[model samples]
Target: MEIREDDLTGQQIIALLREHLENMHEITPPGSVHALDLERLRSREITFWTAWEGDDLLGCGALKELDPTSGEIKSMRTPAAHRRRGIASKLLEHIIEVARQRGYTHLYLETGAFPAFAPARALYQRYGFEYRGPFGDYADDPNSTFMVKTLVG
Candidate 1:
């Protein structure tokens, strides 16, 4: 699979992202869902990437700079048809590597705490992200599981 940095204009990537957002609305309560839409991603606030295999979109993820030495993982989603093929894993690894090389001292993320998020929780655990209290503007939200990984050299 080839992972490429993409603008929100890429049709395959947009479709894959739209699918993820639509599905999240089903698994998560409306007010608590943090999924991003195409216009939101089109902003200059974050750097996004899409993992692809030829014409097939495998998955996508993004890194949002939180501060000088910190970044947050955003919009991590694997296409339903591409699950269990290591597409999410590859995209995550790529994000972490890029974040570290870019001088980010810590990487953090927020995901659902429901059963629907088990696979994603496991994926983050495998990468050494430990549970943490709410960061950024986040409060003590029972619906959210906050995690962080130190990327210090």
Candidate 2:
């Protein structure tokens, strides 16, 4: 599969992000759901990417620059039909490499505390991210699981 920087204009990616938001809301509490919508993901601070197998869009993820020295992983999702294919893992690895290239000292992400999010939490853990308290603008929320990884040169 090939992963490319996406402009977020294609119908497949739009739908994928919509599904991601819907699923996040379905599983997480209202105030604790931190997934970004299409508009929010379009911010100048965010770089979005999509994984494709020729004509098929497999999944998508984004990296948002929180500051000069840190970044946040956002909107990581693989469609229901494409789960377990390592699409999420590839996108995550790409994002982390980009963060390292940009000189980011740390990479942070916030996912749900629910059982539905266990797979996601496991994925992050495998990448060396450790559970941490809230960072950036986040507050202490019982439904949120925050994680951070300090990048090495």
Candidate 3:
């Protein structure tokens, strides 16, 4: 599979992001769902990527610069059909490498606290991300689980 920067214009990517947003809304409470919409993901500080196998999209993820030394992972999603084939894992590893290349010394993310997020939490844990208190604009949120990984930059 190949992972590369995406401009978020293709219909497949748009649909994938829409599905991600929909799942966030479905599983997380209203106020605690922080998934970004298409426009929000286009922020100047964010770099989006899609994972593809030949012509098929396997997954997508993004890295949002929080500061010169820190970044946040966002929009990580593997389509239902692509689950458990290590697509998300590959995308995440790519994002982490990108962060390191950008001179980021730390990477962080926030995911749902529900059982629906168990797999994701496990994935992050396997990659060395440890549970952490909220950072950035986030406050104490019971529905959210924050994680951080110190990069070797």
Q: At residue 110, give the lDDT of candidate 3.
A: 97
lDDT of 1 by residue, 23-129 (tens): 88988886788877888876676999998788888889999889889999999988778899988899999999999988999999999999989999999999999
lDDT of 1: 0.90
Off by over 4 Å in 1: none
Residue 133 deviation, candidate 3, in Å? 0.5
Per-residue CA lDDT of model 3 for 1-153, tens digit only, reads 999999999999999999999888988888999899999999999999999998899999999999999999999999999999999899999999999889999999999999989999999999999999999999989999999999973
Query: Cα miss at 3, model 3 (Å)?
Result: 0.6
Clash totals, every prediction: 0, 0, 0
What stretches of model 3 exceed 4 Å from their correct place?
none
**For each candidate, what is the lDDT?**
0.90, 0.94, 0.94
